[model samples]
Target chain A: MSATESPASTPLLAVNNIEVIYDHVILVLKGVSLAVPEGGIVALLGANGAGKTTTLKAVSNLLGAERGDVTKGAIHFRGERVDQLTPAELVRRGVVQVMEGRHCFAHLSIEENLLTGAYTQALSRSELRDALERVYHYFPRLKERRASQAGYTSGGEQQMCAIGRAIMARPAMILLDEPSMGLAPQIVEQIFEIVKDLNVRERISFLLAEQNTMVALRYADFGYILENGRVVMEGSAQALGSNEDVKEFYLGLASEGRKSFRDARSYRRRKRWLA
Target chain B: MELIFFFEVLVGGLLAGIMYSLVALGFVLIYKASGVFNFAQGAMVFFAALAFVSFQSWGWPFPLALLAALATMIVVALATERVVLRKLVNQPPITLFMATIGLTFVLEGLAQLIFGTDVHRLELGIPDDPLEIQGMLISTFDLIAAGVAALLVVALGVFFQYTRVGRALRAVADDHQAALSIGIPLQHIWAIVWAVAGFVALVAGLLWGARLGVQFALTLVALKALPVLILGGFTSVPGAIVGGLIIGASEKLAEVYVGPFVGGGIENWFAYVLALGFLLVRPEGLFGERHIDRV
Candidate 1:
């Protein structure tokens, strides 16, 4: 089936014909377009320097820092134009980016770092107390180490803290950039499980950028293939899994050496004519 | 012969400590709000006091002079933020520190150019009569200074704890990026911090100027605040007060008793020595969080 007309047809976010240039000269993302359905996990798979992370950043309006300029096209969130809004304003609208490298404030305590996630919420002191309790429910390990400084936590713990901090904002969607980068295979599995749980339970959409194709397809219901800053192919997870061409190129399994079931048909036709 | 005198010195030291806390409070406010060390604090104090003196000299009532002086300090603060600090934002912290030092020189030059480089008496509005409290003689000015400092502390505490804007300021102190993400107007919060810092400096200036004639020497009192910040922790409000009191009282006692043996100037190094000892004991200062790192 065509990617646009699957069971997940309703586009919660639409990136319409976007072009991003760097420093008014270098063209990084060349006219890329994609859509994410509500409560759906969309995986954008690409090699390094394919503008995958840049596309995610563009959606969050966090491109200016990396010298990325959206020269053309726009990103629509919840049927509203969101490309013009600043990153902070976009965050208020429930679009949170769990940036790569797990940026947690090292000097602050874990509890303090979590509180910072609710920076935009105008909750009462009692309500904030309740929210804190809710966060501890999801991350009991953090609760145990709440008073401890964030720097003392392990990499996996820091990643958890980063995710928990983003969740504290009560985001409707989270753009996870390389969530499993530099993690152990065991830890990666656990992290992906948590991501799925968050999506299923909280109904939060996820746009994940990852290099692990098999792992991504294992969890993602739908996926997009990005090549050289463009969406080359997109389809349901199962169709893309079985596509012969996709296997040859992306799945690292080539059909070039395999014989086609065609020469036998010609030989039978010739024998029938002789009879 | 010496015991009675020692008790007298001790009482005097405690009172002086309270006064030092008042001055240190100004440093704490600015440092916490903007992360600017604000070396120009002493100049703000001098200018505020000078303005008050000028108003009083013009035959204005004491309350009128105080009100006018406060108004002037606010204006100065607004101007400083707009002209100097606003321009310096996003610069390196060291660059900003250097800018403040330059500001100190400019303000001193301006004060000298305008008010002349000489001492002028600042008449304390309170009656200049001494009061006897438990066989100790307390000058009315000391009582008034202490009372005013207490009021300042309480009011600041209320503002920080209860007000929305004050909470935003605290958030800014804790994390600037997070504060901006929350839509806290960075410029407005910074301006407010400066205004509050100016107000604190004015109070300290007036009290110190009244105690020892309005002159550049009153600016020197800001030096004592450094040790208070060091001992109390750079970011703690209560630490500033406690640090100040320790510095003030110990310096008073040291000058009184250890002066003969050390050939005087014990007051100059008393706060530093105390700070050194405190650092040796608790490197993070009294109220600062203990820093830890993971491998």
Candidate 2:
């Protein structure tokens, strides 16, 4: 835990002073640390190659697959050290990552895809049946296309299947990697709404990684801005949305008082350092 | 009399096809789970029969020899997983395929060294007398082999279609990373699949050795399953069976009717020619999934 963190309430998931190196040489993430508070959505906002996906993968311990390792840092899940756990063990502990590009099992039927998600749960027959029903309930479109092969589903439906499959695991925290990539605006909105609903109803915490700053800030309770492998700024969503520097740089709204995106951001950076 | 001879040949070819399918089933099981082509599978069949016969010659009873063969196959599976497959996980399919080729040499040499290079016969207590039904001439040995192969295929099909481990195996087959992300222990799955493949190889070996003596040449017979695999598919068990049956029948027919027309012994070339022709039209084989690339 960080020295500055509050003692009143511990975050459900926390990462401290993490450094990640890929292929034993190239560094990708430097001193990155963040937390997902219990039952809250924490958005890591960044553009491509900003290390947002790396951070999420580090948390889920999937970095091993890409020859990336957390060289220095500690990860704690539910206040217990989990930096060493395998991805499967992490899922059994109620943490799962729905990978980027919506990695649906294309050969399996949509329903079969969802059932595969419950592999670790060891649910009874009746319970498994109920879980499938619940997934269908969350995404009625899934039920309509449940028997259809996942590969044939639309991009929107595949994304829903990905999330619905994650949901079937009954995860306490979902490290969702880029939920809004390559989707229509309306579909993105629908997915965000469902995520918010799931958060409210199921009390499942989320650490969402996304490039869409405005939309992520719209739904997230707290946000962190990543730029070039570093956390450039961090604030509550409302505060960040209202901040003049963030508006010009990320929100794409030029504040009359601020000079330009680059100048205003650096100025704020300097100010932050000075303080 | 000619028609009766034709039907007799047809049934005999089918039984031979079933045996080929039996060997291919072992290949399919390992391929489905690990995406490894498992070139060592044919070597395994040769090794299994050789070991079983060796144990029997050492004065062990039939049951003891059978158990010892099963145990040897299990050890081979486990060792292969640890020493070979596990080390090469996430490698390109070609690299894994090449590794299995290396494994084939190692197993074949080991089998020859331990069990000696001489040929040996396997007696499964099944009498080889022809069981004639009216005007039909059916070899009782062929009938027993067909019956055993059918039962084994059904047992495997039901196991994969209905059980939890079967679902996990399919999950691993569908996508390895997705299976891992969903909390499936991929290493355990691979181990289990190799074990299943070993068992299937043993059954294939026993039946084949019962008919033809257990020799280094049995490895060549094991290679014959590849054409059957091509005709059916590497991923589908039923496809293996059907491919086996078709190749079996076609080869027998080719050897009988066509062989007289064009020198004798067309059996060797016939099945492969059929597989090659199938490849030209339906490249993925009959039941294999068509390769689809998503942009």
Candidate 3:
């Protein structure tokens, strides 16, 4: 199918062969492609410096803020071209990106932070209230501490606040960047559970970028492994989980279930991805 | 007689502080929303007062002149946002500060050219005679100024707490990018904030001009308000009021008691000395948020 036209089964969001460059000369993402199906969760898995954030920013059209641009590519939301829209316009069309850091307004109370998320919707008073209630339902801790300044909240609560604020947008899809960063393992599990619940129950789609490869693979329907601004591997969660190469490099697993430290250091056989 | 003299001077100083608070409130409003420490605020006060006096002298009624002056402020706000701030959106704080400094000179020159360099006596017809309350005299003008400042503060507080735009302002203050990501137009918010600061300048100018004629020196009063911002934290509304009160009251009391010892100019630097000392102990000022370092 053409870039503009998609059949009924086409994904909710598709990033087609996008190349992003920063400050005119520094190329960040080289022809990255990903698709997020309707009401489905997808993971862009990468370690540090893997252009995961660049890819997410490319899709959300937030690269402009950093003087970055998509030199060549098309981003489609619901099969409609959205490469030209500003970040605010993209938000109004129900696509919101939660920035990597839990960038809650440290001065604003948690409730105020959530209220700002619902700002563009122009919802009636009751609708605004309902949206707040929906976010509170997902994050009961946020509701309890709604009046406290976001800066005073714990790392986990701040993460919840960031996600809750995105939820308040009542978005059809969310571009969540590193939800697991700076959170405890249990907190990460709880957050992923919430993402799963939102996808299954509310039918809200998610495009999550995570460095926690195992956790991402655990929850995401499909996964893409990004390395040096390129997608090296893409498959279903189960297939990737069982893939031998993925096991050795990403999952910290060798054929014998785990690699000893000395063996890992000595066994640098030059993986195909590096080549 | 001695007790009454002290009491009279004390009340007068408190009233004068309210005018300073009014000017500082203008600075606080813009700084809170856009993080720009607007040096042009004092000049805007001068401009607003000049515009008002000019409008009235041009055969306009008092209320009509007031509306025209306010309209001018709003226009200046929109223009500043479009011409200056738009180009300097992601600029460093120092750049924005320097821009406002440049804006200060431009406004002063414009006010002089447009409204004439001559000082004009502003008589608003409000009774200025001192009233004797139990043998203590209090000027009616001071009382009126106090009442008006209080009213505006309360009204601004209520508006900020209840209005939708007000909530957006708080959000913008929180994080500009976050605010933009959530669909709040940063430019529109900055424009609205500047316009509100302009409104504050009008009220400050009108009253100060009435007390001390509409002239170039009228802008100097805003300079006196800098210590108020220092004491109250540039981000706090009530901090301006309370800081003004402290500055106003302490200066008068010190001038009375310590003027002879210091050769009678203690009021000139009393507020600044106090602010400097207070800030030394607590850098954030009375109402400013304590810095929280994030990892």
Candidate 4:
């Protein structure tokens, strides 16, 4: 997997043979394996407590601090072993995570929050100032409110700030945990649109862990369904979106009514709901 | 008996206040980086004075003795970081505070064990002649001490504001995890802050030692820092200096004017009383930002 992630078609991140145990007794992730190809958004779909956040933490190597031990397994990013590295080291290497909650330094100005994103990058003062100007281009709302303290921002703005902070690292890949967890539908759409834009324009890979299966699967190129700490299903986003079992369980469609719709042959053929 | 005598007392008090600020800066540096209220800071001052005196009396030139004393303080800071503080890094703040209290005892015993309990005079290499400025009779030593204190404060400010390490220290103060995530090494920053704190303590020791010879009594002067820290915010550099000046002046004046009303020893409680009054008005201190944590 590491060797195949070439400059042309490298999987941005590959998680293989990973196991996470809490306190040596209770196991959270049991040998979860997944790969996110470059220039694609892959959603790790699961319900609450399905270890989606843990999987993201394991990939970022941030679980060791919380007694969530990655007992075995390796995470490779841009064809380099990244499993044992600390979060600080990972940030430097460009595998930044936005985390579950926004976790912006609330007391800091919006500008300071962004500067912290480029914390590991030793850029000249003029270069840092220029990079900050570029960040404001993506999230213009943030630019308008740059001098304001982060705590005063709305939840949606805070989420934007969080993503902007990760972008400041100029990461090749980003792990987003519950980016739309508590946002309103309108805000969720806005955040997802920004994510899509980032993926399409910047060519940055994204591995998003989300409970909102409908919204996540809609935008993702590939999808992995995690249940009870294991990958119960993996396929291209289109295939998983139309699978019978996925429709019944993930999309919350009543099994009795959409029995035929469950086995969608193609996105165009599944037109009953569209009509 | 008149207003002229009161003016004299006021001037002396102000000089004392500046000295107190120098001592308080040591606590501020250590606390900002490590979040540990260092009880050993006072002991560090005493030890620094002892080193200075030992070097001068041992036939070293004045400049050489000063350098040797500073080097000793640095060694002490490094040793404290490697031995005592390294072990207590992740411990709770209370536990770390207690460890510092233990450090105070160890340092006191070590100083006594090495230098003995006898008092030693400290000559700051300045002329003992008095200078008359606008009819105020000022000792050259007091003026020099105050000047040294001002210069050190400015140097520390520059070191923290302009240097890479200084920015790293500020990041640590803001959020340790965030700082670490950015690869600002915690252990390295801790060692640097302690070394700088040790340097400040040595300067403070030299000044105080000149006023009252290097003895065990010098260690007790560290108690004066508590008020400075309380009145000035613990994390604030300028606050510490300002708080120290306020406490130093008021206490000296209180000991003279107010002490007559109530027996004597008003200096012993005057600083505390001032701090208590400040706390009642603003518990976060004069310059401390209001810090409220959410559950």
lDDT of 3 by residue, A163-223 (tens): 8998888789889999998989999999999989988888999889998989999998888
Q: Which stretches of candidate 4 lie over 4 Å from their true place?
A: A1-10, A22-26, A151-154, A181-184, A243-275, B1-4, B55-89, B106-119, B128-130, B158-164, B292-295
- Chain A (alone) TM-scores for all candidate structures: 0.86, 0.93, 0.92, 0.89
DockQ (C-alpha) of model 1?
0.19
Per-residue alpha-carbon lDDT of model 2 for A1-275, expressed as tens digits? Answer: 35146221688888887999998999999888788888999999877998999999999888887789999989999889998998889999999998898888887789988988998898999999999998888899999999998888888898999999888888999988898899999999999998999899989999999988899999999888887777877888898899876787777787576475578768767855753
What CAPRI class is candidate 2? medium
DockQ of 3: 0.66
- After TM-score superposition, the amount by which residue A107's alpha carbon in candidate 1 deviates from its true location, in angstroms, is 5.8
DockQ, candidate no. 2: 0.61
Scored against the true structure, residue A105 in model 1 reaches a CA lDDT of: 63
TM-score ranking from best to worst?
3, 2, 4, 1
Measured with C-alpha atoms, the lDDT of residue B193 in candidate 3 is 90
lDDT string for model 3 (B36-109, tens) is 89999999999999999999999899999999999999999999999899989778999999999999999999
DockQ class, candidate 3: medium
Q: In model 3, which runs have C-alpha deviations exceeding 4 angstroms?
A: A1-9, A256-275
RMSD to the native, candidate 1?
Answer: 8.3
Model 4 DockQ class: acceptable
Give the per-residue lDDT digits (tens) of candidate 4, residues A1-275: 22233223557788886899987998999888888888889999987887899998898766765667888888888778888887778888878888777776666678877876776787889988887887888889999889887777888888888888888888878899899978999999999999999999888889999999989999999888887787777787899889976787678785577645436445423432342
lDDT scores in order: 0.78, 0.87, 0.87, 0.82
Clashing pairs in 4: A5-A10
